[model samples]
Target: MTISLHRSATVLFQGDSITEVGRLVEPDSPLGNGYARKAADRVRSARPDSGITFVNRGVGGDRIADLRARWREDALELRPDVVSVLIGVNDTWRRYCSGSVTSARAFEDDYRAILTQVRDELDAQLILIEPFLVPVRDEQWAWREDLDPRIQTVRRLSQEFGAALLAADGLLNQAARAAGGAEHIAGDGVHPTPLGHTLLAEAWAALAGL
Candidate 1:
């Protein structure tokens, strides 16, 4: 059995495009085509009448530093009871393509700062989601070298912040392996297919015990 989280919680899902998934682009949209939508559905189905609210503040193509830029507007102001973050993929992708690299040290600093602000300023329960790439395409392989360390850093940060860790990267990797490879998830290794979103929802529900 999973640990029971607070009922009627206002959960905020934050991160890059993966988390954004066209949620706001569509009018009257409460969820998207990604894990945010899936996880919100699971929580609502399991805890109906709990009066829980799920907010999606994830923006497309965001990085750790970007999150910091919009923290006050996207996160702090939300006053979430539970905050879930799924970032770091864009950081990896940018660096892999000879793009400007945000050093692992810098990633840690920015990430830690964001979490600290949420913890100290908002007093929200944190959920750190480890971002993953399934190597669906040739370009994705290079991402592992740069991305792995950041994923580890996030995991450790999760512990440091007393946040629930959703090992989505590892879990998705395993799911990919079991499903015959990277194509099982994201065809491009960055975005998730419908199946990938399902796996993420399962992992989140199990972790949050919703």
Candidate 2:
């Protein structure tokens, strides 16, 4: 029988700026102000009869290495039934502006390490959110070369880890095509707009089959 969302299920969202969305900084605050909120809203709306708990732990400017640093506290400790992660953009962004260059191989290595630990130590179902870029600016246009592989790694890792995969990037790309261009969904190409958040929630809900 297919499992349905229930009070026993706890969902956690983990990522960088896009996921954080300026949520309540206090540890007391669970869902932040961005796509995390939208995602939570969609889950709640779909399963109003279910009592699943949702938490968002996205931090701005984080990369795979950063996530590796806080894997225990931010994730494993939470003991979620479902865990979702969106990252990688910063791994590329820092290379250009912050002078921190993480090669594709290194990025994948870091990501693998983090997920490996999570799989070994945690009891949650994993959900990998694909990192995306739309090239709103010239600098961002070049980010694809560095970001694509990391995104692909997430896809492969999800299958390897027996996790759910939410195609947030592809959904955004579709929205860009429908609305006009990437700028409409992601103003700066890294951060998403309100519509973009909605699209993310929709895609996530669909993937969750909720």
Candidate 3:
């Protein structure tokens, strides 16, 4: 599907820390130093007079449930023309770190619910970024048992909603191998380093056909 971030479009980025990356929360705020800012920068460079607004509402440690809980205020109320999401890692992270397991079924259910709301209530366009993993350690590889299914869920939903799908998991791993190690991109197998963020931003732009 083609997603056009047309003139005067307000694109909202939603998800966990990966999207948030320390963005400020204030009037006339600047996007944080992460992929969201970088992606916006890429588009603005090509269309200087587009008058586009990019909003980042990524809260660190947020699971799908957390995002749905505040969806009305953070997402729906903004009335964005386009919405991009990079979530699900924290859902698996919490399982390993805090014993909070979010089954893939629950993840898909909550995700579809919000997407339905976005479509039915706002008729906004969607761009779904697949959650990725690059295991720095052998143990982190175990995360695949949890993350892979969710990645598939993202793909299915993207097709179901006719949204642009950024195949980030495969893209990042390919980059990591070329860069010599996963740590070079995502130091912790989760959050991205500067280069990793660049990859995500470029991938987002390219896949969204920006």
Candidate 4:
């Protein structure tokens, strides 16, 4: 079933670079040029009088631990009615590139902690987006071993927390196949292109029933 947003609700998007998309940190029009912006636009267009306010707090290079560290200020205090989170890639990426490894267990723990806080602090709905890689570069295929488990963790936690899950990995993979190749969707296998963001927005809208 599609989750419906209440009128005058505050919707918050949280995650890493994909969600950030250069969003302004200030109060006015914070959604950046990414899926969050696209999704917010669609929802507002569909119901201009819904009185839904959107906020983006996604920072580049954030891992689950980073999110846990800032949850109180960036999320809880906002008193959002709906929260959407897309994270975990950096947790796996840093291990391969920067040698800063965050194990799957730690990732799950931090993620759960954030969700627990949200559940205890507010009557907010949750949407968890799955972390994905497109394998645009041959070396990127190797990231699956690390990212796959984190993806599973998100799926399990979403169920545990009664949150909606967006199967972004599978959705983007299908989009890549249809669009001719992975590079067409995500040029570097991690960050998404405009078309990739569109796919994400459409998938999010379909999942949220906006």
Candidate 5:
């Protein structure tokens, strides 16, 4: 059965650019212009009386290390009941593009540290979204070698932590295949388009039973 969020629960989303998507840092509009926002909207629409609160702390270009640096401030401090995280793509991207490689072991360690902190400090329910690549460009196919292991790592960690796992990669791939191609979902192979974000929001809502 899908997990149901309690009433008045605070939900937090943490990740990279895909999750960031030009979100306002100001108090008024916290959840960005991506799937996070869409998901929030859907939840409110589905349960207008739930009084659930949502926060988006996703920063563009963030990797696992970056999240580690700001975990206390962005995540723990908020004391959210549910924390949804989408990361790791930038870790893989930096290796190929900038030669700033983060080995799989290191990635898992850093990630586990964040999860451990959340578990110990807040005891919040976790939703781990796997990092995905659509391979819209031929060169993007090579990213599979690095990203796949990280995805597996996330799956293992989710089970270990009793977190809900959102299989975004496979879901998006299937959407892409039905919707003509990856370009329709994520034109850049990394970031999702409006249609892609909608798919993501729907997937999260369904998986989390929001």
Candidate 6:
């Protein structure tokens, strides 16, 4: 199930390039032009008096291990009321682009550490987004072998932690089939197009009760 955000909730979105989306590039735009901003903006506009603050600390090229390495500084320090994580795709991308690969076991271990810390140290809620794929090409279909495990891991973790789950994987697949082609969503089969971001943002906002 999803979460109903409170009035003073501070939502922090964490993950890789998909979540980062050039957030650090422009001086005025700290949240970047992606789902994180879109979702937060939706909530902020709907509830102008919410007093809810949203922070984006996502870094490009970060995998589960990378997030683990920096969680204490980026996440724990922020002390957000709600932590939303969107990782694991790069853990599969690296295996195809480079030789680097993160086993599902390592991914789960690192992911668990961060969640455990949050449970123990902070009074916070968790929102875990599934790493999705909309393969435009035939070869990209093979990525399921690497990505499916991680997606399953996130699903399992969400249930284990009783956190709000954003079921992005199946949504994207449905979008790719019903609305438009995969390219209309994620041209590179990884990075999202504007339409893709909007779709994800709408789903996230619904899940977060924003």
Worst lDDT 10-window in candidate 6: 171-180
Q: What is candidate 6's lDDT per residue for 138-196, written digit by digit as tens?
A: 98999999999999999999999988899898988888888669998889888889999
Per-model C-alpha lDDT, please?
Answer: 0.86, 0.81, 0.91, 0.92, 0.93, 0.91
Writing each residue's lDDT as its tens digit, candidate 1 over 104-209 gives 9999999999999998998888888898888877766777899999999988998899988888887887888898887878768889888998999888888876
Candidate numbers, best lDDT first, in rank order: 5, 4, 3, 6, 1, 2
Off by over 4 Å in 4: 25-29
Q: Write down the TM-score for model 4.
A: 0.96
- Report residue 61 deviation for candidate 4 (angstroms): 0.8
Error of 3 at 203 (Å): 1.0
| Index of the highest-lDDT prediction | 5
Query: What is the model-wide C-alpha lDDT for candidate 6?
Result: 0.91
Over the stretch 155-175, how does candidate 5's per-residue lDDT look in tens digits?
A: 999999999999999999999
Residue 66 in model 4: lDDT: 92
lDDT of 1: 0.86
Clashing pairs in 3: none
The candidate with the higher lDDT, 2 or 5, is: 5
lDDT of 3 by residue, 104-196 (tens): 999999999999999999888899999999999898988999999999999999999989999999999999999999999999999999999
Lowest summed lDDT across 10 adjacent residues in model 2 is found at 1-10
Off by over 4 Å in 3: 24-29
Report the lDDT of model 3 for residue 111. 99
Over the stretch 47-102, how does candidate 4's per-residue lDDT look in tens digits? 89999999999999899999899999999999999999999999999999989999
